[model samples]
Target: SQQGEEDPQALSIQEGENATMNCSYKTSINNLQWYRQNSGRGLVHLILIRSNEREKHSGRLRVTLDTSKKSSSLLITASRAADTASYFCATDTTQGGSEKLVFGKGTKLTVNP
Candidate 1:
């Protein structure tokens, strides 16, 4: 099974400062995705990086993957209060003739104004 765990379970930063979160996973995966959830709301997809790619960016969000190290990192540039949310990294596990997404514990980010 492919499972992921994020580092710095909780982080607090001031507005305009960049925030970084790291995730590590086991086994093989086809792609790694980052998602954000504000409070009790549903998840909002941030970005997805394929196995063959090393890094990707979308607006203020950036994601990097290292298959050799089985790790990934999410960086939010120019953070804002609205960006305060729980970030999660999900990996697609394709093994045993089946595929499923395994999510990490998540990192809680707080951007103070």
Candidate 2:
């Protein structure tokens, strides 16, 4: 499928711990992005990893892409209670000449303080 697929559908951890999520897709993509969404709110773009890029980091967030495996992983270091949210991996894919961001179901993370 052109849509991304995230694994370990849900996760729970204590504050100050680390969180890791993985995503896989079936088609080629120009870039893959990770997003975080708090409950009842819109998504916030975290980072984008281009097809040619291997890894990227922002603050406490780290993202990695392996184009050969069509997979990506997102790591959050020293997670806080505020980090509790649903995280999604999205890719820019074209369908019928129109480009769209296809997102995975997402992994819901629960951070307990």
The best candidate by lDDT is: 2
Query: Model 1, 1-113: lDDT tens per residue?
Result: 33899999999999999999999998889999999999999999889899999999999988999999999999999999999899999998786888888999899999999
Candidate 2 TM-score, true structure as reference: 0.96
- Residue 51 in candidate 2 has what lDDT? 90
Q: List the residue pairs that clash in candidate 1.
A: none
lDDT of 2 by residue, 6-80 (tens): 988999999999999999998988899999999999999999999999999999999999999999999999999
RMSD of each: 1.1, 1.1
Using all chains and alpha carbons, the TM-scores for the candidates as numbered come to 0.96, 0.96
In candidate 1, position 78 carries an lDDT of 97
Which parts of model 2 are misplaced by more than 4 Å? none
How does each model score on lDDT? 0.93, 0.95
